[model samples]
Structures are given as C-alpha cells and as structure tokens.
Target: MVRAAMESGELAQVAVDVTAEGTDKLFTYLVPRSLAGRLTPGQWVRVPFGGRRLVGLYVGPAERPPEGVALKEIAGLLPDIPPIPAPLVQLARWTADRYLSTFPAALRLLLPTEARRQEVRTLTITNYRLNVDDVEALVSELRRRAPRQAELLAYMARVGGEAERAQVLADLGESIAGPIRVALEKGWLTAGRVARRRDPFADEHVEPAPPPVLTPEQEQALASIRQELIAPPAFRQPVLVHGVTGSGKTELYLRAIALVREMGKNAICLVPEISLTPQMIQRFRARFGGDVAVLHSALSAGERFDEWQRIRRGEVSIVVGARSAVFAPFENVGLIIIDEEHEQSYKQEAPPPAYHAREVAAERARLEGALLVLGSATPALESFHLAQTGVYRLVSLGHRIDNRPLPPVTLVDMREELRAGNRSIFSRALVEALDQTLSAREQAILFLNRRGYNTFIMCRSCGGAIQCVHCAVALTYHLGDDHLACHYCGYTAPVPSVCPSCGSDKIRHLGAGTERVEQELQRLYPHVRVARMDVDTTRRKGAHAAILKRFADHEVDVLVGTQMITKGLDFPGVTLVGVVLADTSLNLPDFRAAERTFQLVTQVAGRAGRGDRPGRVIVQTYQPDHAALQAAAEHDYHRFFAEEIRFRQELDYPPFAHMIHLVISGEDEAAVAATAQNVHRVLAEGGFGGQILGPAPAPLAKLRGKYRYHLVLKGPDVRAMAAEVKACFAAARGKWRASRSVSLSVDVDPVSIL
Candidate 1:
C-alpha cells in the first residue's frame, strides 16, 4: 500500500504547531515512502517548512495539493510518544471551533508540556540479574578469587536475584563497577535496561481503603451513573450529582469508576485545584492502588511525561487530576467525573482556547460515549439549569451520611461589633467561639478569601491607596517581608516610611487578610498553635500537603487560610469554622459574586462537624441579612439558586444567554481603546444581530502594564456568534489602524469578566 500510494502521489494534511495566525490551518505535505503505511491521523511528526523543521500533527489524508503549490515530505514521526487517539483529534477540532482558538492551541492542550517540546523521554536504568542457576555455589567459588564480585552476586541474590545498577553501586560502592562488568563478561550475570517511571507519589504510602456501605442516596446516585455507563443513549444526558457537602459524592464517583473498570473501560476524575489533587489522589489510590495515575500542573515535567506514558500505554485504568486531565489520552473512556464542578479554576484564563474543563469533559464524553458525572454541593447555575431543563439527569444527595446534620451557622453583624467599640479585626462572637473551641481541645478553621497581611495601605492625609505600578488594583502589604506587593503582577516594593501621595507618615493598614488574622489569633491566644494555608505560604511545591498534614495531625489547633481551604478538604478534628469576613468575595464587581459567596461560605462551613462532634460556624459580615449570606448560613443552596437564577434571567446573564468576551489590550491606552471600538464596529456591521454591550474599559482596566478595553457579545447560540466574530475579525484585520500595536483575545463563556 505504501509503494502504490507513493507512486500515486498521496498527500497528507498536517496541522503544523506554529502559532502564527495564517498557520492555523493544515498544510498539504507529501507522504514519504518511509512513513506511508506507518503514518496515521493524530500522530505527531516533524516536517520541513520554509527551510526549517517544525513539529506537526497528521490530520489524515488529503486528496490533492493546492493547484500550484509545492509540498514537502514529512521528516519523521515523533519517537517514544504514542499517537494521539482519533477521538481526541476530533475533539480537538471541536474545541478549536467552539472556543475560537487555533487548531494548534487546542491540540497542544492534549499533550504534556515537555513532550510537546521533545525535551523528556522514558527514564531507564540498567539492572543486573543472576544468570547462574546456583548463585550460592558461584558466590562460594568466587569468594577466594574475586571477593567483590562474589559479594555483589551474593547481595543481588538476597534481593530477589536482581538489583538496579545505581542501587548496587550505592550499596557496594563504585569499586564494584569493575566486578559487575567482569561478572557480566564471564556470563555470571545479565544486564539490561529497565524503564524507571518517575512517579510523583513515590515517597508517599497510601493504605488500601475498603469501600464503605453506601447510603440510600449514594446508592441511588451510583445506580443512575451506572445505568448510563452500562448503556448510554444516542445523545446521552450527563449525570449531575447535586450532593450537599459530606454527602458521599466521592464514594459514588469511586463506585462508578469501579463499574467502568469492570466493563474494561477507563475513567478520568477531575478536581478544580492542585491543592485538592493530593487528597483526591490519596483517596483514589487507597481505593484503586497502583491502577491510578495522576496528572496535574504541580507534577514535575518528568513525572507528567511518565504518567502520560502510563495512560497512553493503557497501564492505568483510572486517572485523577486537575483541569487539563479532561484530555487524558484514554482511548476507551467509560466515565469522566468533574468533582467540585462549580470551581472557576476549571476555566483556563490565558493564552488562546480558554476552555472550561466541564465543557471540554462534556464534549469528550459525547465523542467517546463515556458517562460524565458532574458532582458538586453547589453546582454552577449553568449546570443546574441544564439539569432542570432535562439536558442532564439530576441525582440529589440531600442529607449527610449517618444522618449528621449540617453545621449550625451564626451570622455575626460586624457593624454591631464596631458600634460596641471593638477595634479588633475579629468580632466578639468569633473571638468567643475560638476561646471555647480551644479550651475544649477541638480544632478550628478561620476562613478568609484574601491572603495578604493587609488588604491595602492607605494614606490618611490624601485618602489614596497605594496601587500597583502596572495594574489598577491596590498593592497589598506583606508584614513578613515588610513590603507592598501586587498580587496581580507579582511586583514588590519596600513599604515607604512616608505616604507617597501626601508625603506624610499617616499610612494606615486597612482591611484584614489571612496573615493579619493569623497574627491577631496568636496575639489573642498566646498558647494556641496556628497554621496558615494560602497562595503566599503554599507557593513552594508540596507546601499544601505539609500545611494540611500538620492540621490533620492536630499539631495545629487552628488553620487559617484563604479560599484554598474552602473545598475538597476533609478534616475531622475541626469543630469550629469562622468566616473571618464573608463579604470579601461578595463585594467583587463580577456578576458571579453572590453565587461565589454562597459557595465559599457553604463549603468552608461544611468543613466543620465532619467528625462525631457537632460543628458550629460563625460568619462575620456587615450584610448579615443578605440573601446569599443568609442562604449559606442556613445551608440552603436551593434558596440561593432560586433568587440568583431570577436575577440572572432578568439581567440575561449565563444560563439565559451565552456571552463572548473580547478584550483588546496594549501598552497604549488610546490604541487599545481604538482597537476595541474597531472590533465593536466590525461585529455590529458584519451581520451579527446580538447585543454588543461595550467598547469600554474592562473591570480590571490595567493589568501587568497593559490597558484593556473589552466588549461583551450576548446571544442565544454561542457557536453562531463565534463564527460571526471569527469571520468579522478575519475580514477587518487589515482595516484597523492600531492592529499592529494592540492584541485582541476572545473568551467564550468567560468565568469572570475581570
């Protein structure tokens, strides 16, 4: 077939990995005889382009080359890495089209970071195995002549007749290298290279946990998911497991994965954050053991490559990881579960193809006929709306396991505390609760969504807040470093003795963060042990696990953290949870602020009373009677969603309309604004009938030294709007005068406008 095809002038359409605009489409290439029969769609290959070699993905055959253009032959297929599955190739195309991204960008998401760069390979080490039938006899015979060789053979035999070269050298010293070579030459031992996987969890020991008896609600949820797994419909409706916190949603995921394995298919479990991966991995490992593989951004490049290899080679039946794991290259996927399906971390914010893992997972499931389970205590309004509209099968786990009641919540009005002459950051109720909880020898969790020592430093004389040089946001004061830092751009500066605005020593640290809360707790309770978890403290690798371990071991009496500790954490020692300020997220400019506040408050509250003791939560907020805060205090998601959904419907927010956010940014504010206007005009004039809301400054007007202007296009069908936007941009690219100085980014179904 290869020779015949070569003679017949066969052509292959290759999507080169270059990111340039015009290179987004496939280029025709000649199929060399060397790769003719071996080539397949989705295989990564090297090809020549304009006197340079570039990596490209084979996108199947082309009937003919463009009329008069010359085609180049593929250099060779990428070695070691396995070809991407055909289903994934199709899924990538769909993602590219739906997300308004280039083909290469969407394709790149399916590959490991180092694998795409060809910078990593399977690590291998040499091993020596005893070739002699009787190792004891040989050792005794050589003991007199070659003592080192004899000792090496004896050691190898004791360790099951084989040992890695590195281990042997370390044990017997490098002096045994000559002996090992001599032994191999004399036919006394055999040496061969064995693949050594760089497992990220190699240092941790996970004990196998037996499956617990399922509650009736859990059983029903599992049955619904299992039914979909056993026999899926032509257009399968995803299973939405709307379980309250502590309702055993994870158990249902585990059982469904087990069922899929029994049916000879694989499973992918996605968590929202890397902080959650450790606990989720431990649980999955405890249930599935070595059959599980984890993939996430936190893993080293080598570990990621090895794990990808394991998944590609079909060595792992279950994959548990963060957002990108939705593209886990499992060929026959039977299930994909998005744990904490409402997390915004599941959405990619930068670079092109800003896809949400939930959307990608749903598409992948549809493509491969896999069952998608979206499990969340508070589902995203969009997902819950889909469930309500019959697009998804809703399974509810309304009660906690063992009939444990949801934690009782206390709403503390901070205004009353201020009126009562309290100047401290903590309210009287929270301070009292902490004292009682500490006296009772129980643990507590203080939840604050912010992470700095102070929210901002303001000059009392000028009433101006210190702001980031590159961004419009205020700079946070870090007490530990004695510096002011911009969380958005990571720019740091020394804390000035005098206010820059007024030239006066009247700078006041206003608003408390996690760091300040920790300090205040230590000052109030001198003997209390506290641990803080947030982006600041957990920036180093494995820091999250370390802080969590200390809290779990009861070495720390209280854990103070930002939103990182809000979900997927199961600490049984915690009997008290204090929401330092529930209004932090509630006051954000984003429309999802109310919903986010409800989720955060409810999730952090669920952390309490997970053990045998009844739990209590004290939420300190100025707006104690706010619907979101009240609903969260009562553990009533339905009430929050009911009111929130009405607001969304009235305002035409998500679940009622799909929005395409276009942000034009540059160093020159005028150019950016001009480009945004041009984009708006093009959309309005190019046959788009949707509402174009803005050519105004973005909520985050300036970030990382760039001025941003955005436009929001709202329509009923996203695909049609995306098509119109793409075509309009392509046609208007040359007409805009500021096109060269500014850049435009399109986000389909943006999680946050900021």
Candidate 2:
C-alpha cells in the first residue's frame, strides 16, 4: 500500500500567497507528468491566498511537499513560456525583506499577466531565405513596388534578415502580412517568432556617462565615503550630508551612485514626493542609461509593473522614485540616497503603519550592508544629532557648487509694517524691493507659507459665520468660488448668505491667502505678470514643472506660492525672495513646530539670488522675536541649533532620547480613545517605562472620517521602546478586535506629531 505514496516520482504544483507571511514559502500539490510540461516558474497561477482566489507567481520546485492537506493544482501557467530566471527570484527576496512585505507581493509587483485582458495580435508575413541573390533581387523590387514591404525588408536587412513567422505576423497585423508574403515568396525574407513589445517605450534607454563635478568639500566627503566602502562592509553605515541650500549634495550622490554601478551593483534614489521623481529621474537618466527605472504614483499600473520587472531582471541599474522606491527590487544594492531627506514628506501622513521613509531606509541599508546617504540643506534635528554624536558620519558640503554667497535676509516685523497703516502683509520696504527687482529684469518669488491663511469669515452682527458639520475646525471662505471649504476633510458648500449661528447678514471674508496676495500685487504692479503656485495650481501631473519652467524662463515677473515653492526650485534670475509669513508652521501644537518653522524659514529665505546677482530676502512675520525666526533670518544654524538642542535635551526629546509615536485611529471616537488608553496602560504594565506622553486627541483629531489619538513614547533605548510597542499592539489586539470600530497605527522614529 506504500504504493510509494506514489507522489515520489510525480511533478508537484505549488501556490504561494501574496501576503507578507506566505510569500517566502509555497504550498505544494501533487501533479502527474502529463501536466508538467504546461507549468513553468515566473508564470502566474491561480491559488488560494488568504482565503481568496489570488494569482500567485509560479516559483520553482517546492522545497518540501505539503504533508496532509489536499493541495490544488495550478490551473495553468501564464504565457505557456520559458521558465522564470533565477536572478529575479533573488531580487524578489531582497525587496520583500527590505519593505517588510511578502515575497509573493514583491513578485506580483514585478510580474504582470494579460489573463484578464482582451486578446490582441499583430499579423506580419514572412519568408525563409531560400536564396541570398534571389532575396536581394526581391528586396530591390519590393523597396520600389511596395513601400510597406520595403520597410520590413530594411529592418530584416539591418539585423541580418530573418523574417518573423506566425507571432510576428499576428503582431504586425494581418493586412501587413499579405504584402510581406509577396516579398517572402520572392525570397526577400525568412520567418521567425518573437514576443511583441508590450510597451512601445519599454527598453528606451541611454548610455551611462561620467558624473557631474563636485566642489572641493564634496570631493573630500566622497573620498571619506570611498574609505568607508573600501573597509569591511558594515550592515549599516549612514552618512548625513548637511550643507547650505544650493550645495552640491546631489552631485556628490551622483558620483557615489556611479561608483556603485561601476562596481556591478544597483542603487535607489528616493525623492520626497511624486512631483520630484520626474526631475530626479531625468538627472539619473541623463547620467545613467535607459535602464534607470522610475516609480511613482503618476505611473500607470502596467508601466510600473513593467519597470519593476525590468529592475528584477537586472536590466535596471538605478531606481529613482518617491517614498515607495525605498523598497525597489534592485539586486546588489550598494547605495541608497535620500535627497531632501529631512523633508516632512518622508513621513507618510496617512495609511496603516505610517512609517517614515528616512528611518526605514536606515533599517533597510543596515540589513543589506548598503551605504545610506541622507542629504538635506537643513537636516532634521534627529539626523543632525546622529551625525554629531557619531551614530552617523557627518559629511559637509560647505559651499554652494555655484560658489554663490548666501542671500542677504532682511526681517520686517508685522507690528512695524502695521505702524505704517498699510496692512497688506507686504511691507512698503518689500514692495520697493519687489518693484526694483522686477524692473531690473530679475524674477521675484513671494513666499506665503499658509495656503488659506489664519483667515476666517465673520458676521459683524453675530461674530460667527460658519463651521464644519462633522469637525471642530472652522470653514475657510474661498473667494475664487463662492464656497465654504473644510481643509481638514474637504467638506465644501456654497457660501451661506447669512450666519448660521444668528441669521446675521453681511459676512466678511477676513485675512489673506496666496490668492489675496496675488490680487493685491497685480493691483499695485499691473505691468508685472504674477503666477500663483500652490495646491490649487499644481494638482495636475506636469503642472509644477510647467510653472517652474515659465518662472525660470522669465515668462512671469513675480511668482507667488505656498511652501510648495521651496522644493528643489532652482532659478538664478530670482533676485528677491519675499517671505510674507515666516512664522507660518511655527504656531502648530507640536514640539517639532519650532524645528519645522526654522527649516522652512531658512530654506525659503535661501532662495534669493542663488545666481551671481547676489540675491536679497525680505521676511515678514508676526514673531520676528522668536528664535527660529531670528536665527533663520540671519542664516545662523549654529545659534538656532544650540537653542533647539538645549530645549530637546531638557525635554528628553529626540537627540536626547528616541521617540516612537503610537497613533490609534478608527471611525468610532470612543473606540480610538479607548485603544490609546489601553496602549498607555499596557506600556505601564510592561514596566519598560519610556515616558508615556499622550492620550491626547491628535491635532487633527478627525481626518477622513477617522478619529485619531496618539502616544509619544520617549526613551534612551530605542530597541526596548520598539519591543514595548510591539507588546502593546499584541496585548491590545484581542480587546480591540472584538469591536469593529478599533484599530491601531504605530509609527517608529516619527518625524511629526501630527
């Protein structure tokens, strides 16, 4: 009866789940030899994944056969093609571990199947070369008699004339095949078959070239980086490049990345957002070859899949993309570069497990023995502290590569501007500066950090105009359209004629936004063209670049924008930078607000006169006395850092101690609050004792229909802190899961309180 369990000599069918848990292993089913020929690795196959019928990537022979359960056989292998290459499997493994995602998920990201697609074909006729002389004669005749046939002949001739047989005929279209058949009958070509290019733009590439030059400081920094790589590899060797704005940090990265590729390895370049990917990728593409893959939200799913596959196949030498690219399936990754690494966009504001890319990149590089370069004009305090304390190597790009001096900053206090009775937010001094700059044929950038202002609508009689129905936040009056909008959840309605609270008429839209600033500037300087750039203008994919190009080309006399104006904005003609609200992000209720305000004020003010023109800056803020505002206005990082670092140490915040943010959110406010309380209790129970700071409602407590609460756990031992967090999640799971309204979100090495 041991009838050999009969499975010994038979083929096996295996299905792998796509979740983070199952991808590393496969479930096997016995298969007779008859269907063995129909199966191949890398092909998509139907299987039960997490209680659902999911298409699992067909990986080679199961390491061990499933013992008792009756395994389902693969319905079919997609493409009925060649086996999947071994190299791609290795790439999948690397990416899966890096992202803490499942191996099957990684594979699915890389491989795309046309299983649910409409069948299509391109038909092309072909002929075997029966005689070389006869083929040449027929080609000559076809080149004149049939121009379409001549096109095909020319292609074959250049690649050593072999005609595509059946598949090519189907792909080239049946109509083209008929004329090709006439040429083939005359012995002009031979037939063969090939996979049609799914994307016409696929494999579009350029040859790699020498990297751009780096300044002396940059060269020295790279020399040290080379020294680090030359030594025995450390699992994680993080390097922070902190330089003034306009420093050659990016070029330094380009050089190091080139060195990596030259050594037969891969690299990943992570930008802050999707908007930056295109520009960053263009640089990589120009320097590297066509194999530079770009991944971002803007890409079509099919295109993203194709690019991911190309990366796994070792066809891509570099991956340039937004936050998600940190998990790219790049094999032998020697380097990871996070440009503008301190930008808040590195932290995901929504979604589960709200991880910060900069912190996660550190973990991934540590795991893979990769060199991590975090470059920022103004490094985050945590990162700067790491560099100062020797946790990371400090590489300074001391001067702008252009060798331009820092812009001269002039502070204009709002109280002083008000004393002049011209409460336009733009001081008379700022106006004179703007007028002079534009008259001299130079561009001006007006910076207003707030989008909708601290602005609000009011009824003179009732003193109350409007408020959101579901939120505790005020409704903003958008004068462009007669609408009242909630910036929190995007609840919008037409502006009411009367105050909802007391039925009072004659509502006044008070305060200023980019729109108001733009309108007033046009009134004062009508001949100067003004373009307002912010969320409202750049919602389109290519809109940001178009506006930036216009500004660079001197198409617009003045540029008015929100904080979006500061990101990678390069223009030598921008001689004056007007900071209409230097204290913008400072008033938020987070401890990091001071640091953020300093970063923005300094970085945005640095925008002026980046060229040889010797730029000037005019900063207007209510709190000119605030240290962040004063220090940024003077471009004195040392003064600001000293004061901020002292505050952090006193409070046992980051640099003094690590902080982990455990955010609890759900549709039910009470449930979310309860979950946070339960988390705090569990932390206390565990006795790991990190300063448990919150059970407070999040600054934006309700977002996108979810009520949020948070706990800022601070401690010196980050490892122990993380472990305690894990225990809390596990301990609270049972109690919370009993109710559908409860969920927990944990963010490690959090960048922002909000």
Q: Tell me each candidate's TM-score.
A: 0.97, 0.82
- As for candidate 1, its clashing pairs are none
Candidate number with greatest lDDT:
1
RMSD of model 2, in Å?
Answer: 5.5
- lDDT on C-alpha atoms for all candidate structures: 0.89, 0.71
Rate residue 614 of model 1 by lDDT.
Answer: 88
User: What lDDT tens digits, residue by residue, belong to model 2 across residues 130-170?
Assistant: 33555466567767767777666655566565544553455
- Backbone clash total for model 1 is 0
How far in Å is the alpha carbon of 67 misplaced in model 1? 2.9
Worst 10 residues of 2 by lDDT: 115-124
Off by over 4 Å in 1: 1-8, 274-277, 737-739
Q: Candidate 1: global Cα-lDDT?
A: 0.89
